[model samples]
Target chain A: MDKIKCECGHVNPEGTVLCEACGKPIEGNQHIDGNDKKTLLNMRYEGSARRSKTYTNSIVDKIWSFFSSVKVGVWLIVIALIASALGTIYPQAEYIPPEAVSRDPAVFYEATYGITGKIYYQLGLHELYGSWWYMILLALIGVSLVICSLDRYIPLRRALKIQKPKRHETFIKRQRFFSETEHVTTDEIHSVKEKLQQQRYKITEENGHILAEKGRFSRWGPYVNHIGLIIILIAALLRQTPLLFLDEYVWVREGEQTVIPGTDGEYYIENKKFIFETYSEEDGEIYKEALEKQEAMVPKNYQTNAVIYKKKGETVAGADPELEVVKEAEIRMNEPAKIGNGFTLYQAGYQLNEFHTMSFKVHRTDDQNEKALGTFTVDMNNPKHEYELDNGLTVKIDQYYPEYELDDGEPRSISKFPRNPAFVFLIYPPNETKPEVSFVGIGKNIDPTNENEYKLGIVDFDMRHVSGLTVRKDYTLPIFILGALIFMIGVIQGMYWQHRRIWIHPKGNGVLLAAHTNKNWHALKQNIEKAIANTSIKIVEDQQELDKDVSKRGGES
Target chain B: MSLEQRKANKAHKMKKRFIFRSIILILMLAAIVYALVANFNKDKSIYRAGDQAPDFKLEQINANNELESIQLSELKGKGVMLNFWATYCKPCEAEMPFMEKLYPEYKEKGIEIVAVNLDVNTLVVDRFIDKYDLTFPILPDHKEQVMDLYKVGKLPSTFFIDENGVIVDKVDGALTLENLEKQFQKILPKK
Candidate 1:
């Protein structure tokens, strides 16, 4: 490749389509055919040579060109959007039942939704957003955006920066809007310059030639938006890194603390109390109609008084970790408590009146009135093997069932929740030879042997509320917000402004006038016509309009 | 400037840009590949079949009926049956008898059954073990740490690990005696 030197004595880089200083079309360039004056100058990138257009041999050049193509970029965006839409056709695997997802998601989809769901599962559409192929699509789009902007932005910047006030007559004539005058006075040129200055155009003059440019910053709008889009895509990909994104749920009983999941055991949250209120007739007249429509009581508010704690230091396994209080706040629906390290806890749900403790009394079976001997309270969650009553009788637990149920002829529990608690008590009386065995529940009392000297009777029970908190950790939130703001700025800059340039030069005893704009050509032409008013210079005509009329007549014929 | 010299300089700049862009593209591709590979690998927090059973230490009632801490990593060379259960779970109780019956026979064949109880009260677990006469190691997860470690959503969930400590099979619900024996055979030592 040989460097081309324009007749004006300006040296240009290899593959230069037009001289950087003088704007003269370089001979032997592929973009220029023999005698280029007949066609409009391809002013995209200001006729500057771009890497993607110049190179085609090497593999790197091929890859660059592939990503630089606006066509390819548009196609990638369309395909990605379609793929994302397909993901929403059904519930994602994460939203499905936990048991189904944990055991076999394929079976669940097939069993629930039949053939389409099976196909969806088989194609891995249930987790479409997380699929490797979908991520690759997004990565390809990001790469395309970066390359497309780089392919043109560098050359455009260089062309704008290296531009001169003087340009060749042929280049000016080939512009979409062009005109000429046989005689132009220096005073008329000065008047035109003054009018352009009034219009906020930046004017540059060299040897009586004038170039006026306005809104040049708007030309960088597309590239700036592309950069913002690339940042957004990168932030989306960053979520794959561990701890950058977290969504988990934890249930903490009133007065009990629970370790927040995804915090690496570094944080814990305690619920002091769970408050639940419902709208009633006594609430207000405004909610009367809405409340009356609901068959069941409508909830008005639910909040959890939460206290966050951070682990102090390393602790041995199976031992309690020492915790230091971090903060305390009330968490309600849509109002989350912000803990440090990008974590927030929201009150998601509440279970009211869960069995917490149960009390029992030892009763003598021989007494007519079933006189109570001694009373003992049992913590349903952490029960003791034996309980000593102040009245001198002792009762020992032989068996316990938190959620008791009868299966066939055997007594067992269906679950570990203290919903329907039952217990087998061994009542030991003072100075007695043997202990009496009794089966006791909330409303049932039976002696298995049917000949016990003592029995266990239910006394009182206590219930507490459990609050469910959803913990969310998103460190990429600030980056996403920044990207969105930059994108909005780019869009506003591009849409609300236009880059306009006017070139005026003396050529062969006549003055040539040409105008160009990135968009809103009508506005630019009107501005030019008004600026060159009351001057000897002729108003510029839109050559594109004349060409379109000629083409239309040719079509009609 | 000489035309030849200017051409050479232009070529050098192009090559430099190409190298710089190539490195960036390669690095981006590498990051994407790393993310995909990390996703393909099972998260250690979640346990499933074919995953390396996460090592944990828990307290169990031994032959002396006393609380003794045992580690899963300590039984690496033995085929282990790790069962997450609670004394209140009926399905877990239904499978206990089969586990107890197979415990003696399998213990002689380099197999060990370890039950992790997700009960808040150790008394219930002890009473259940006594009533069932279960001889296998019964660990009490009083704080439910081991339960959370395995992410057990339901009771009677069992992980069958081979001698190499890799989980060979996992059942989320109750298994019959025959099914339990079959699963045990899968993790039994070859010899």
Candidate 2:
């Protein structure tokens, strides 16, 4: 190949096998007989270089290069996979409150995932998806999609559009399939060219020789593949929608109607029937093993329904969706109801709760003082409630589980629901010099150690059973859908397109032809060769005879 | 074709190929990023079994020596037992002696217990500890950090954890001695 001035004006960087500076092919090209070869990026880069204008190599440029280079693109994928996995290994390092996450946090951090995991959490790697570095990595991939596609698209299109060459001699000779055949007559060569053309192959003939080719899309598939990828990437970028999750549990008792708490306005959640289903005994055994493994829960179903109310007077909520309680709905494991603002109401967990008031009294032990610590109601869900006794003591009804279970080994629930609700009570005494708090189980009250002023007595106790339900709404579902769609499309386009090429050279005896294909070459070459072989009108005895006839015909023409 | 012309033609064609092949890689990356950003602002719902418990910043009479309060943020990505207790509470007092016994042996293995004291009587609180032979760190919660945040209306509410510190469950009232020991084993591997 002779040195050609690449549009880059850099002499195509001399034997540049490929244009590193401008990204255009610089040698071994058989398509360009004229000057129309430079791509958009090449022309621009060349123009800037020629003007000697100060071009600040911007971040976009680095990103452009990074994305275009297969090496860089591969690196980004590696980084993302590793980072995403790391994120799974650690926590986000953020939370709701101190008491909410009460635990020995320091030792916990040091033990798992190790020092590195902790560092990753601090660096926000635990929450790597939205971090600046992660986005940049993704953006680099996006740019790569553009640059890589641009690099290949223009050239592939130009190559596809290339007209038949003046002669296919050198090109055919360079192919792995070229063969010298001499037994053909001049008439036979003409017939071969005619046959190729009849078979829908594009051909160019010179003197007594012929060149034929077919199925050029295969050659351009990768370039097309690149464009598809870019479109996919752009689609992905468009898909970047940061989500806001509302993960609070709200009470929706079997009979009451309530609104789901989230930024996307209130939703009418009516309890048509809060029902629970259990696994069959046999299936439970099979799934019990699965449950022990913590595999997905063997779910039966947790169903509910309620009147959807736009307002207190808005046609009565769940009883009619449009104007009142409408329909009965059932929710189960792996099944959730889509509510509002990309929210899904899932049946995460349940509790056997209760609602009851406990009666107690406090009398002064000291003859000098008289005070009465009275009774109160401790709502299980709302534990902060308390009663102030006349004697200046505050009693908060802390935790109360109607069906309580001990944390020992067996996981057994209290046999009866509301018949016996367990209570955790915390008592506070008012003292200017020093305040004191005491914890007591509902039936196990201990009097003040002062052993002088006051003693609390339990007069009466009551319990009722209720169901505890957990609510959840996460917003990443749509992105998952979109990603699935893109992957399928890309794979189909990449896997199905086949590339086929043929080169035919005219020589003295007849036409010398060769065929090659990038993919599906096995079947394609066989068919094209068969077609060409059949097209030869007649065969001369030998090379000597074929040459004699071809030269004589040349003279006559 | 002249060598120069041939080179130009090849350059033109190669550019197209480069562009095409790389697009797939780019799209894959974009898809991953999009998925991530989509989930970013949503609640992580991170507190789970095998997840680290979240750390908190706390003020204790002793942390003053370090001139800094406790930091709860660091505790996540590990397992721990964060119990909120008050001085006068019987259950809280009953649980301390047990926690004190298990803490030393399990602390190195990964188990941690933060006894947040919401004692009405700080003076009486000291005597209660001395009365039961307690050894674990008792963090005073005068600010009610644990109370207001955890919505703790009950005393001796202990949060259990697995290897990763995410709170697995919250226990109210005094755990039976056998139960506390079993839980300590569950949260921490044998040292």
Candidate 3:
């Protein structure tokens, strides 16, 4: 029994191809066994342990090897995919349910979906994306990717970086493509070098031997892609942190100002105007209409002329604070406007304001006779002001209800449209502390018991639109975008590029050339043939010759 | 080293690697199981029953028709009925009279009703208040801050907060006089 001492002073077994401590090839220690030859050709870091142990004495070592396993990585990915697909079976919690349902999710689910809903609730699939298990799955995958890449990358990089121009006979012989020529001249070697250089191969020559390599960066492609994926996963997790991502919907009526939610009143947006249009055919009929009425008019475009403002003064108690206009922009569907450094405003939807204008008649009525005192027009757009009548009476427009209705004996506005317009008016006689209240509809009125004092009637009314804008602010957007770009680059590099290497050694006035590639053996063979096209170098593609040569060498040794 | 010794060393290394890998796999699986169990018992909502309500400030119309700001934190020791409603919502209109009817009786018991109006139109809110003769604090959530905070997907949502600022119950629809009384009883401070 004998132990071989490496140049680095580390003693390894005699049969070892490399120094176990430093991952360096142990020269002149040739066992030239079948397994040794396979290790030379395929194993990048020959000195390092190739397979994980079945049992470990220490707990930490056991854990380390678990994460380092490619099998674990694949299993994690498969499980995560299955869980994600299962999540899609029922809509995520964030998406709005299709119908008007109960606020109690359990009750709503049970009522709507029955047994499936029960299962969905019991399994906690309603908020699957944000669920702890899903988070753990992502975390495990991230750990797996990190461990798997680290385990292989360091050794591969070391092996690739310290590659030699001349290789062992066993190593050269084991190559998929090999060639030996007799009576080779220096001129032929020069021509081959020139052809390889022309083909963009980086060449290194030492001691009458040449090593040409290309697409070395492709070797790092998988690791780079893994890094990008890890970054994307981290960014996704970061998005869950408060203030990193904020998605809020704000409904702004035209000419109305409101503070943006989640901005802490730091920003305010006012809707100057909302414009809505529909597509019409040459026949002057709205496209996608049902019968004579417009059932579902194909929306042409919608835009909201919004003015963004920054809070100027400290909001004093009981006082309206001043806001300075930062930017004025028209936000349309698909076109988002950036507000400050964080927020982006997008036009999401619109609601039509049906009550445009209300024409009212002030009537003075007695028990015997009723006469119209005066006619007045109240603009629905600005329905906050009071109008003074000529009969020493003040008519203050309190509320304008479009599509007014009485539900369960309670007065309410059904919709934004002016299908049934109503108005609540407060009539002050002269200097009364409390004004008389009256509810007036288009053709009816909730008349006061004392109709002799004053009566109001709504003559006519008209309609207009308001836009719904979605304000979004995500700090992790840049990180997510960068990760996506890097991932694409990594994928392209890994899948499209092939790492190829060739070794050329002068064997007693003749040359022996050997070539190997991580992928695309046919392409590497073609490249080699093209490199030595002008020379008299004939390639030995037959495996039998290589085997015979290796056996003879072994016999001689 | 002898061939037998070298083989033994290799076997030992393989054993170590296997144990290491197995440990990591087991730990990850354990973590997944823990997360699943924890998730099953967790309440996802920010404002759920038995949880302390997040405080907010809103502009409320006072007795003089002037806009005055009111903060929920100021009424910490008093029972608070935090209601999220829009003027357009029918159930909200239906429930206002009942709320107004109970306000006087509850006010004597140190109970405060903070009705948050989600409508952008101030005039509509003012008129609705005047029409209903509601004496309770009518807070106008012009930006719908309180609405968004409570995650009010539907209108007329009411949260009954006890004197300790803890949410006792959350009712989603319009409440009648009887329902309001029952909810108020739960939130009313123990005397």
Candidate 4:
């Protein structure tokens, strides 16, 4: 390496702008970029020789400089922020119905939200966070964070570690705060050192030169913050792994058990009961006005008494497996039940008034008394084909429709659930060889032959409520929490403290006193003034003000 | 230290840090890119036409009200028409007669229609079969597991699988008699 030999018998690297051992500016170094000799020195990075500032020849150098530039990092952040805002103009793909997206997203977007939505969908903004360009933007920011921190941190640490408390007239003169004291005694210097020590500054002395330093660890704040940000970004990316994250939903009816989705059949949840309530005027006086004005009942609560079970044996397809009870809890809105294996079940929705069981009575058509010959109850979930009653009367279900409807003059069921049950019954009376056929439904009964002797009448029925639960498992939550904690610590450490240093150099029967701080120059000046109180040393003045005055005078000349 | 030695030491340290950071960066990017590519390549959540139909086993109420299970893998060699429906879906009722009509004729040609009933009540499904006089197999998805597995957003969703177990076509709504017959002919197994 080519070296620059300074007048103080110290050598510096070829690209070094200032001597490292002694703070003397090396003039006429074309590779180094800084303020002119007239103004205060740009001590942002301690006048250190950074690689980004010195090298721009190779491709690697260019890439390194590109990422290490704070300007580039800020621009990347701004672009990412704007893109994230644009994503919120419409719901993301996850918020959209999965079936609609799977069937055809383009059609759904256009039909639902018009032309702008069509354009958004076409640009792949529907899945903005997951889009390739967005991911690339995030990756670029991560690269910038890594490169920028490394570029500045290493050189600054080196500069501070090798710093000396010695004579450098120009360095002292260019400091933001500088002062000269005439005929200062050794006792005064000793008193100043004692005052600084009382203020918790570490004092170092060399050849009657003293340097008081405090809060040097605050210089590492930005680097620590960058590290935390990188960890958070990595945690966000890990969510894409299926093993670390899962979200699914299941519907469990009252008195029924369902294998929780996304558990690979290891967990089962049963809904013991579901309770849903709506606010009425009688409940409270506060909601009476709102309820009356809205003319709608507002839901107050949704709770599900649920039991979680763990599969104890091997799962066989199409067969019920043995289960062991794990825990039972009442899952309510915003109060999810935590099952084992990082799974949590949340009450999502409920279906009320679902048919449970229905009963019917067989009656004589000609009797005015409406006396029933036989009565039978049908379980909506599982009905019998035959029902025997007293006096040798029998009623047989020839056909059944759980949710009955008329299609082309024929009776049919729209669904398997007993929403509107209907049945064809063949009734047999004692001492009769021929059977009478009767069609029965919720509110309708018809005899096609019109010669039936027996009729079926509606009796009573039972209803149930079905509860919907969402199962979620997120393993990256702890990583995010850890990253946020580190970030907070870094922010507080960096913002709430300043790294201050004051250098005292003996100069011709007096001392040239100069001080510098990374931030809050006013506070550093006040500290120095207080420490030298009652001594012969005068108050320090900001030399930047003197520089301005000189420039104004030179302009007039 | 001499300026020459200090510069050499810094350069060596810089090279080491660069290599270490580069390795970490490359590994992270590789994992992210791999995940993105893999997610784009195969979305197994919703099946489409030309994909292999996912196999499942479900129990159904037989004529004698016995619990019997049927596995889709056992019917791999036969042409399968898998229909997902609920008892309350009206469109499903409109299409059942067409399915029943084609089942007898297509059974001789190695095409079988399997209706999956997404109902909580077994009696409702049994009564539905009796009403339509459906001769085809009826499998009740009691927990609606098969319904979710097929990603059937709408009722009367059907998949026509050829003899090789690959889905030839997928229909999301009620099919007309002609459309149903055409779908049956498409999945007819070769003699």
Top candidate by lDDT: 1
Displacement of residue B142 (Cα, Å) in model 4 is 1.8
Q: Taking the tens digit of each residue's C-alpha lDDT, what string does model 1 give over A317-342?
A: 34467999999999999999999998
- lDDT tens digits, residue span A274-367, model 3: 9897766654554425433666676778999989998887663223557898999988889988988588998998888656677787776552
- Sorting all predicted structures by DockQ, with the top scorer first, yields 1, 4, 3, 2
Question: In candidate 2, residue A465 scores what lDDT?
Answer: 29
Clashes of 3: 14
TM-score between candidate 2 chain A and the true chain A: 0.55
Model 3: lDDT of residue A280: 61
Q: Which candidate is the best by TM-score?
A: 4
Would you estimate the TM-scores of all the predictions?
A: 0.72, 0.48, 0.68, 0.73
Residue A349, model 1, lDDT: 84
User: In angstroms, how far off is B12's CA in candidate 1?
Assistant: 2.8
Candidate number with greatest DockQ:
1
Q: Of the pair 1 and 2, which is ahead by DockQ?
A: 1
Model 4 — TM-score against the truth? Answer: 0.73
Q: Which ten residues in a row have the lowest lDDT in candidate 3 chain A?
A: A548-557
User: What lDDT does the true structure give each of the candidates?
Assistant: 0.80, 0.50, 0.72, 0.79
From the highest TM-score down, the ranking of the candidates is 4, 1, 3, 2
- Give lDDT tens digits, candidate 3, residues B67-175: 4767887888889999988778767877899999999899889889998877645667767787788888888765555665677777778899999999998977677
Better of 3 and 4 by lDDT: 4
